[model samples]
Target: MKNVMISLAVMGAFGLSMPAMATGLVAIPAAGFTGTAYTLCNTTGNFGSSTPTQPTTGANNTCATFPANEATSPVSGYTLIASTNRNAVIGGITVGAVSDRVWRNTAQTSCIFGARFTASNIDWDTATTGTQYFEVNDIARGGFGSASVNAGYYIQATNASPVYRIGRTFTSVQHRAYKYDTAANKLLLGTNYLDLPTANSVNTALTGEVTGIGPTVVASTTSATQDAIVNSNWIDFTIDVAYVDDDGGSNIVSAMTYVEAACDSSAVSGWVKTGAIRLRQTGQENTTLQEISIDGYAPPGSTVP
Candidate 1:
């Protein structure tokens, strides 16, 4: 995935011409996706992070300018607000070419994030006793701790409790953004700007098999399927309120907390600027977690000296 990102960057650095790209729509899956008819536009291209300009739809959805590559990058009109890379061996799993990034649009109203785990041979077999978890966070400073509790907004998935969830930090609350409306059989959140029923399409671990959201896990390279190495390898996300019903309920139009903080007078915690990823590989100690940070860029709507 690093190679894919670098290649795209190189093409931009050169005078090479790329094809035209546009955004597409994404559906937020409700419990059984029973009565949820909401959808958000896919701001990033088909390559997700690699080609920011081309957001394709349906089959053969790669940007016309570049070949289909399972990588992530900021979409057109959006800036790379945060990015980080991880290359090492964790828990005997060779972690290579892994990147986590967050992108904010020009209006500062929305942000997109993506992570690619191109590392080979990451035996994520269901038969194993290991557990895997992934989460995207916006915090004041780099690294993870109590600060990430409700910095801005986040989406998390795992093989344990709170299987899948999303939240925003407008008020002081423990996991405020994640609330399951059992009676309605829908997900409730402080700021419903997060596209519900969100799924990690590129990564199998974050798919319905683990998070109970989005599409079924792609078939693994192995006959039995369930290998994260050969099947689910990358993940991407979008956080925006540009649609008709940003909150998924009330059908009332609204703005996202991150957008309000960056553009309006909305009061909340410190700016939801820093974006991070936390992962707990299967078989890792229950108390252990790995966090990656992308704190290099200044928050949108800020003055850079």
Candidate 2:
């Protein structure tokens, strides 16, 4: 009967562990998670006033986010491309801290600039509402038994819609250097690099800010359990993409966007259950997450300087 996000009081109640530090990394395979995974979200904009792309579940998962004006996005026109054709059976919940890649294309339409972005979800997927809800885990009161697989980081989306708000739960994430798929609409998630972009990681919100002292980690024993933390401070993760223009035409496009979130665990919109002591489905554990990193990007090349 508590907030699904695992309250700080609950953590304090469970903090009576064998040997652990207040701000140290949690052991891996903790919180019902055997490995690590990054949740991804896409938005449209520049650092100043960019907006997250509308989460339209089952509507051909969007890969790009174009800002409103040139001041908002680098894409000439405020156009976000949606690819058709069920290319390689995409869309599903992937688990663990696995290596993933991001690629985008115009789907053979031959657009001016092929652009798109993807990010790691904070706790669950709040892109859809009403039965289509997807979440990592929700802990019950008294540390009964709970199970969760949220990697503690999400590139959340923000808006008035219930879905967007729910998507920004727990921990937030930041991304960089979205690559271009070799195939027209194939959003690749692996190797094959060209020229990468420089990325910097700032703990604007990082995951611990809203969730726990560390990443989202939980362990439930007989009477005590370590789990997600709950705070209400607005969390922010930003990425600034820079493109230098050697051509006199001024084709340089460098901009960034910020994805803000909160440490709320209301469980209202749509929160699923992971691993917890409440359900008697979890056991003692620990997990340490790696820092987020930017993938890679290639700027448009020109002969003129």
Candidate 3:
């Protein structure tokens, strides 16, 4: 199995309008891979934060919107393609939405996954007293061996209530990856982890593990402990899976994951990158992943082109 590494970060001052809505944008990386990749940002936290709110019978709980200009970059031998922007809604209300974008290195990519939400408005601190809180969800390739992965992150606010806060609060960075079996509709291997700030200059890490057979894997991991805030607020994460297929033998696994943190600033955080590489099977050569810098800022203007 071969191990490949990918590093990523977001920079610049992007403009964001108020009114409590969800929006998404896509971007293509410099490198390419064999499988397909999709990025989704949902009102739910599965991708990161909580979920959006929705009415039971029929009300406005969800909505959809579009992003401005899409960007693309080429790295290695792959072409990264991004999307303009998109919106996600729950029930009828618009929790928070995202831009639906994807990157494909080849046509042989197989996987149809994205992100979703449960509710639109809920409180995070108290849920009952504080403000409305939301939940996040993720969708991945259904089958194993030849499946693709898709995930997203988003935020939502309470409509009538004025407790919920919108826009970038504290910078929170997270990442996850999974292997699935499309045939039986099962998840083979997966990981869910989160990194957040603690105290003054410390950061904490939280993680969840998935285990079991085809399509019936069970998740049983504790929440991450509170750590110092390494980088205040904004951060980036990436996951890479590299493997080899024999004529009729077992599938070789080579996985590499990375995390990038930006420096603390009243305006934005500076970029800092870190990564880890490992092989699932033995007899394979070990690989080293490179670190990349990231810049964070707000986008200017209301129209995206």
Q: Which candidate do you rate higher for lDDT, 2 or 3?
A: 3
* Candidate 2 residue runs with Cα over 4 Å from true position: 6-33, 41-186, 192-240, 243-305
lDDT by residue (168-190, candidate 1, tens digit) is 11100111122222312122322
Indicate which candidate wins on TM-score: 1
Q: lDDT (CA) for every model shown? A: 0.25, 0.20, 0.20
> What's the TM-score of each model vs. the native?
0.29, 0.19, 0.24
Give RMSD to native, each candidate: 18.2, 23.3, 20.7
Ranked by TM-score, top first: 1, 3, 2
Worst 10 residues of 3 by lDDT: 275-284
For each candidate, how many residue pairs have backbone atoms clashing (under 3 Å)? 14, 39, 70
Best first by lDDT, ranked: 1, 3, 2
Model 3, TM vs. native: 0.24
Local accuracy of candidate 3 as per-residue lDDT tens digits, 83-152: 3223333233343333323333343132111222122232322423433222221111111111111112
Top candidate (lDDT): 1
